[model samples]
Target: MGPVNKNTFDIGPALHRAILGAGGHDVAISDSMLASNGAASTREAKAFIADARDAGQTPLKASEVEQIHAMPDKAAAKLVALQIDLDPARSEMVAIAQIEGVWCRAMIDNVPLDARLPIYDFKTCENASPEACQKTILNYGYDVQAEHYRQVWQAATGEDRVFRFVFQEKTAPHEVCVIELGAGTLLIAGKKIARAREMWDKCMQANQWPGYPLGVKRVDPANWAIERWPKR
Candidate 1:
């Protein structure tokens, strides 16, 4: 990886560190990065970046720190109930191995200590409510991600493991919700993953990664838009 790029203030990653004990992955936050009410900074920002890089620390703004500390305890409580823990040393386990000659890897956010429990991965999002996250899951193809990760587990253990996501809010209150995809959603996502794998294998065999169609493409309006036109 090249030199780490600075995010504007870098709130999300600092938040992740505080919540998940995911260390050494977040970029360093700078002084000007936190100043001016989260505005972009000048030379001071660059100086802070240099300093943070040398020191290997990303200090969160006091306000940002407050938000992280204020995250509801119920989140941790929920993890405990799920047979997972917030302690990284004890729980942060990663599976990296080959799944039938395909090198696969997955960082388990909170490894289930109990054999009966499902696999859990944590996500920080704008909203942790099921109503909001259901859309997020589908729109972002998280169902496919879950299926893929499950395959990783299967490759390691020779058994199918149920996968789940633990979503926590980034903003105030920092509500948390744990969710598992329904069978139907997983089925559709699994089909998609299988199709993608087949395509990838074919591409590798052909040694030709094709791009867009070799022709001028015409854009068309949606069928609903055509129907909305007044029938004349």
Candidate 2:
């Protein structure tokens, strides 16, 4: 119900994005404001959950929630399998990968196994196309985000991995497009790490609040790009 332990590991494309944004730029909000905002969002989410229960939706029991919390390695298992196309027999044992020198505290599926691949992050829009997704990496400077995750994934899994972003429309599923790393994907992880380090250093000096600098990319301009990846 309450925000899970802050220390609980959650590393995906978005989380990496948040960390980069938080560490890099001087955010408008102060640390205290950010904490308060987190608390409010938690409360609102709980209220929404309670409302769902009142509406006769199957309410989540404490044990069910605990069970979900208890099994955190499923994501690792699923991502390694999905991204690498690694079947259990052809490759080394699938194990959960660690980032920030810590493994994720969430599961990919019901079965608990180590996930050895980095996941692509996609925020879908209703009208996204594959081409648009690719462009997002170029236009928005998400190259850094994808590169950082790739490095962490590779370190944990000993395999090359990529994280992608997708923005889609809420009303139209067909409008979704993905954002992926391009030429920069081949660069050493140290590059993004160093960039993040610089951004973080700047933030620390500026007394800035930390979070991802999420810029909403309008679908209007990406129409041409989306057309390039039109559904078959």
Candidate 3:
């Protein structure tokens, strides 16, 4: 439901035509294995498939398609087990708000209008285990994203809501992990957001954007980094 590759978008209807139905969308079996060359039905089917693309239709193939299809199974194993249905309109909920007079927007992955559930944001990655995700969380500043989404949601709905990240692996196995921030992490995130907001406000007021720091500063590597580097 989040921003997936372009192939995923058009593949849905194609699969529906090829396989009768895939991911609840119709993709007719497009592979013409039985219809011999120069056969009238084969020509018609090919024409129809093209027309479907032009008019929009489903038929599903390619090893790439297999990999893409595999993704839903893994994702569903987790989300379905948790009773989460990412139906359209419910997924990709856009929330916009004005924070400290600065406009902000959030494209939330899933928000159940009918039930009480923590807001869920999705991320595709190389690993979804807790340990792997912890490093990723910090490296990618997902904590900041969680805090930002929370702020935007609060501003729009006037309700304080919990946030969760649904991290799914991009490769084989496609493992998934659902994570929530602890109190300490949330506190840290709040501070980071505040600092960023202050910087944004200042930039807006001055109408001057900045690149890297103009001031000359010393650079030093951490002990761990120094130790990790190989000796030549």
Clashes of each: 0, 33, 21
**Candidates in descending TM-score order:** 1, 3, 2
Off by over 4 Å in 2: 1-118, 138-141, 163-167, 173-180, 185-192, 198-232
* Model 3 C-alpha lDDT per residue in residues 1-232, reported as the tens digit of each score: 5432334225533322222112443344444532654232566565655554554444343443675577667877787798766654566678999988878899877766754568877777788899988899999899999999889888998868788887777678878898888878889999999889889999989999999978889989989888889763
Superposed by TM-score, candidate 1 places the C-alpha of residue 6 at a distance from the truth, in angstroms, of 6.5
Evaluated with lDDT, which candidate comes out highest? 1
Model 3 spans with C-alpha error above 4 angstroms? 1-61, 226-232
TM-scores for the candidates: 0.79, 0.36, 0.70
Write one digit per residue (lDDT tens) for candidate 2, span 1-232: 7533342112222222221222111112122322353432454445544554455333233333333333223323434454533232222122345555444222111111344433445342334556665565556656665565556546665666445553543341223343445554547445766566576666767989678768985656477677777764
| lDDT for each candidate structure | 0.71, 0.42, 0.70
Q: Report RMSD for candidate 2.
A: 14.6
Model 3 CA lDDT for position 122: 71
Output the lDDT of residue 206, model 2. Answer: 92
Task: Give one digit per residue, the lDDT tens place, for model 1 in 33-59.
Answer: 555667435567667656765676664
Angstrom error of the Cα, residue 165, model 2: value is 4.1
Question: Model 2: what TM-score?
Answer: 0.36
State the displacement of the C-alpha of residue 228, model 1, in Å, after optimal TM-score superposition. Answer: 7.0
